[model samples]
Target: MELSEMQALARRVRSKYAAMETARYGREWTDEEIMLGFLGDVGDLAKLVQGKAGVRPRDDLDEALAHELADCLWCVFTLADSYGVDLEAAFTSTMAELDGILAAEDTTT
Candidate 1:
């Protein structure tokens, strides 16, 4: 799917979570809850990496890592949506900065 499609899907998932929260907890989650959820996903990715490094439960390392990375992206996209941020712009700018840094390092060495 395209990035726009992925963003829309993330929003739909967020709405589903909101509906569940309202039904179960009598209200939707606060922004803090969303932030914590994102952090939790990051922690999960770290654990998955550790597991692949043989520090925890062994599994299909490559597949597990891909899923963990996708989870991380979902959390990032969700958080960006919450804040009305442009993910494509952010990614583009960051990649440009990284490219410049790498080019400078190459020239220096």
Candidate 2:
């Protein structure tokens, strides 16, 4: 699926979670709080990445790494949607800029 499709799916999932949070805790999580949750997921993803790279030992490391990556993606998609970011365009532009920077550095060197 495309990034846009994934974004829509993430929004629906986020809405469901927000409703559940409101029902259970009487309030939905703020955007900042959601970002913090994303940070935690990032931390977990880092550990799983390390394990998958054989820098650390872990059982079911591959599966765990995949799950963590998806978790990180979900958080990013949700956060981007909340902030009105066009993530697909942003990603494309950012990568192109980075590529140009690297190309320039290579030419200079």
Candidate 3:
């Protein structure tokens, strides 16, 4: 799916989770709380990456890594939408800047 589609799906899932959180914890997660949850997902992804590197053995390593990566993406999409960021545009701009820097470095070398 395209990035926009992925982002839309992520937002929908985030809304569902927010509803569940509200029912379970008296209110939905604040932005900071959501970010903290994302951080936890990142930690999980880091371990999964180790497994992928064969440093940390895991059952179903590939599947676990894919899920963790998706979880991280979901958090990023949700956070970006919540904060009014045009993530696609920002990503494009950032990549261009990095590529430009790399090209300049290559010329110097």
Q: Which candidate achieves the best lDDT against the true structure?
A: 3
1-109, model 3: which lDDT tens digit per residue?
Answer: 9999999999889889989998999899999998999999999999888888888888899999999998888989999999999999999999999999899889556
Candidate 1: misplaced stretches above 4 Å?
Answer: 60-64
**Which segments of candidate 2 are over 4 A away from where they belong?**
none
Give the best candidate by TM-score.
Answer: 3
Using lDDT as the measure, name the better of candidate 1 and candidate 3.
3
How high is the CA lDDT of each candidate model?
A: 0.87, 0.90, 0.92
Candidate 3 Cα errors over 4 Å, as ranges: none
lDDT per residue as tens, model 2, 6-100 = 88999999999999999999999999999999899999988887876788878789888888888889999998888899998999999999999
Task: Estimate the overall C-alpha local distance difference test score of candidate 1.
Answer: 0.87
lDDT of 3: 0.92
The TM-scores of all predictions, comma-separated, are 0.86, 0.91, 0.94
Error of 1 at 14 (Å): 0.6
- Candidate 3 displacement at residue 86 in angstroms: 0.6
What is the descending lDDT order? 3, 2, 1
Q: Ten consecutive residues with minimal summed lDDT in candidate 2? A: 48-57
